[model samples]
Structure formats: structure tokens, C-alpha cells
Target chain A: MTTEPPPDAHAAFSAVALTAIDDVYRFARSLTRDEVDAEDVVQETYLRAFRSWHTFETGTDVRRWLFTIARNVFLRSREKGKREVTLDDDGAEIVDAALAREAWSRGGLDTILERADLGPAISTALAELPEPYRAVVVLVDLEDQSYESTAEVLEVPIGTVRSRLFRGRKLLQEKLMQHAIDSGLIPQPTAPVRSTE
Target chain B: MNHGHGSDDRTGAAAMDCAGAMDRLFDFLDGELGPETEVRIRQHLEKCGHCFDEAGFERRFLAAVQAARAAEVCPATLRARVRDALRHAGWTEAAGS
Candidate 1:
């Protein structure tokens, strides 16, 4: 399940290197959001961690190190494929366009929100989030890791995690608010929540 | 739809309307509430469409968070690439640079 320091021999750690699979895959899923991609990330992380298992030198936080590798894989993927992805923030606009198309589409972005079509908007805003902040958010909000665990995964100070999360939420709020207004889902302040869709 | 506050609660009257409620509403929907407080918030949401819709926004926001920039798992051929890289472990580098 987990790797233990060696006699180079411990049954528990030796049996299967899958102790952290669930955590690994879940965070990986949050990172890549595709089950198959996540499976690969986990597979890659495990193999790497296993190989480096000896050099682990007795005191390192393997999970964070493994996550660093996983994060790298993510970064590499983004860099390699950035040209292909949409990466735009007009997600709310897209939602509006989709809803408008459906003559039977009664609910607006709010309904979209219910259905999570707002994934695009959230994704757009997430793209706007800088690297470690974005990573921290993925670990915290989506994967629900504890604060210390996130700091470990990002290999940052605990304080950095707090600041990034705070700033990240502010940025998201501003972005989402702007989107809500522009799409006519939430009315201008005068009408606010009651505006007709 | 109705934006006006009802006459029952003291805080309801002193504060802003549905718009103002929407501002605090995201926190409510994010499930940040304490147990007792969450109950009250949910009760409010259960009755109000506007606040309920705001909750919907939080759900969609979560979905976006989940899907955002997430890896698109490559097809089986791509999987084989990863598998090949994985075979090498410590020296593993994805194929094709």
C-alpha cells in the first residue's frame, strides 16, 4: 500500500506500492479531470516513486515529490498542447449561446450552473490563475486536501498556500461576477438577482 | 420574480435585498457553513429560487474547477506512449519529446 524504509524489506510497504493510489489518482483527476489521464499520471508517479524509492534518503515527503512529478507532467501537457485548447474566458458567453439555442432551454446560466456547464467559465478563470495558485486550488477546493497537505504537494510554505487561496478566491469572485453580469443572468445591481433571463 | 425580503426576520429587513443576499450567497452555497448555520442557510435556499439558483452557480463553478485544463486522456495509442515512458520509470520521459 505504502512504501516503508527498507531492510530493504517490509511486507506492508513491499507488497504493493499502491498505498496512496486513491489520493494520487484523485488529485491527478483534479489535475487532468479525465479518468484515463489521471490513471496515467498515477501510473507514472508510482513508477517514478518506486524507482527513486532508494534515493528517498529516509526523510523526504514522497507524496509531495511524487506530486511534483505529476504536476510536471501536467505542465508539460499544457505546454505541449496549449495551442489546441480553447483557454478562453468567454465560457459564460458559450453557456448563453447554448441556452439560447434550445427553444426549450428554460433555465439560463443558473440552470447551467446547476448542470455544471459553468465548468468552462471556472476552467477559464482557473487558467487565469498562476501556476502554484492554480495548483493549490486544484488540491484544495476540488480534491479537498488539507491545508498542510496542499503546502506539501506544492512544496511551498504553508503561508503561501493561504495567500494563494485567498487571492485565488478573490480573482474567481471578480471573474464570476463579471461573467454573471455580462451574460444577463444576474441583472445589473438595480435588478441584481431578479433580472429576466 | 420576488426580490423583496419577507417581514419575519430582523436581519432580513436591515440588510440588502436579493442582490445583497446573492453576494453572501456564494459562501453559503460553497458549503462553508457550520452545521447549525448551514441548516438555516439551506432552509432559506429551499424556499428562494434566486438563492437556489446561486447555489446552482456554485455547482457549475465546481464542475469548471474539476474540468478546467484537466488532462484529456490520450487515446489508446497515446496510452501506449505513456506506458512506454512508464516502463523506464526514473528515466522515463514521454515519447516524441
Candidate 2:
């Protein structure tokens, strides 16, 4: 006769997997950028995860595994084609820290937090980022995943994760700076100085 | 990766310049830098008011993003749906055996 797992085995699986439910859903929403699609992806991720539970290593990171699966499912769907924007390198140079500090002290960061309403502005900015950059930011900055773990989740080299994260944060900063100016908190300064030294 | 710092000795030299410090700002903040490199950057920030403010702004910006993300809670209905699906799958597996 075939042996069966004890009834509590399923319960144990649910307990551990359910702890990551919110994380998975939030990641799904960030990737899909649409409520319906995000919900569908989360559902599909859970089902696939359940079916493949036997393959999961006992001590490994379950969260990253779920994210990998979720991202794969999203990519397989037709909506993937619509979300492939790449980072624009023409404006990706690092800003001079001294000038950037001057601008920020002159109401840049404060204005972004106060007038633009931090939560919504950040959410919108994150959503507007190109997909590759957005994924890195979401996985690293927002989710607090390590660069190594993020590399694994995105299936890219650690160097790519670092570069994407740097560029992504830079882009987000630019957006917030613009928001600060548009909110009348600060006047736009001359273009950021390109340091040749 | 060497920014032309000729000697391995970082101390007693002039503090890191703006470019050098800024290049490692994120890595420094993320705790990814080696202890010696981190000390060099920290020493630079101590002397460079401008770089300090720049680092401060980025730190706060990252904190704000984390706060915003923490505020997001998963919907109850979705949690329930996932729970039910797992339950059904479990039953199905048991029956098939």
C-alpha cells in the first residue's frame, strides 16, 4: 500500500507558506501593475507552489522561491510584452553630491515628503519606472532583499542587480526632485553639473 | 574598481573626494562595503559636509520608500482564496492516493 503523509503535513505547509502570502501579493502587484492581473498571478503562484512543494529544499529561502515562480508566471502571460521598458542611459550619470546636497537642503526632500504626499508619490514613481529597474528597486529597496538574493530572484548577475538598483534609485530621485519643484516648494536650479574631474 | 588611490594605505592621506565617496554611497549605506573601505568613506563624510547632506537625503528617501511599502497590506479575500485552494489541493492529493 502507498504510504500517505500525516494530516498535519499539509497544515505545516500552509502555516509556513501562508506567512509569505502578503509579501507575494505585494510583489505581484508591483510587477503586474494591475489589480486583476496581480490577483491572478498571486493565485497562480500559490497553486504552482503547492504542486511543487516536494521540490522545495527545507532550509532554503521560500520567499525568493515564490517570487521566482510568480515572476515566471507573469512573464508567461501575454501582459509581459507590454511591460518591458528599459533604463535610459543618456541621463544616467551620477549627480554631483555637493550640488545635489545643496538642492536637497533647499526644500527638495522636504517638499517631496510634504507636498507631493510621500506614500502616493513614491508608489506612482515606482510604478512608472521601467520594468527592469522597477523589479530591482522593488526587490532590493522595498523588500529588503540582499543584492545576492535579488540577483537570484531576477535571474541576473549580481553586478546587473547593483547597476540596475543604482540607476533605478537615481531615476526615482529625479522624479521626486521634479515633484518638489512642481509643488512650488523649490525653484528648479540650473542643470546638474557634469563633473569632468 | 580602484579610483587611482596609489597606495593601499587609506589613513593619513587626504580624505576621499566627492566622486570617490559618492561612488560608494549606496554600498556604504547598504552595509556592503568592506570594513576598511567603509572606514575610509566614513572618514570622508566626517570632513565633507556636502557629501554628508547628500548621503542623508538618500538615506531618508530610502526610508520613506520602505515605510510606504510597509503600509501595504494584503487583501483579506485573496488570503481566504489561497487558503481554500490549498485545502482543496490537499484533499485531492489524499483522495488520489
Best by lDDT: 2
Give fnat for candidates 1, 2 and onward, in order: 0.23, 0.40
User: What are the per-model DockQ values?
Assistant: 0.13, 0.30
Output the worst ten-in-a-row residue range by lDDT, candidate 2 chain A.
A90-99
How does candidate 1 fare on TM-score? 0.44
lDDT of 2: 0.71
Per-prediction TM-score: 0.44, 0.77
Q: How do the residues A143-175 of candidate 2 rate in per-residue lDDT, one tens digit apiece?
A: 878888888888888778888888778767666
| Per-residue lDDT of candidate 2, residues B1-97 (tens digit) | 2223223344545567899899879877876666667788899899999999878878888887887785666898887777677666662323212
Which prediction has the highest TM-score against the true structure?
Answer: 2
Per-residue lDDT tens digits of candidate 1, residues A57-148?
A: 44555455566667666656668536323322343343344334322222333344443345556655554554445567767666555566
Global lDDT of each candidate:
0.51, 0.71
Worst 10-residue lDDT window for candidate 2 chain B reads B1-10
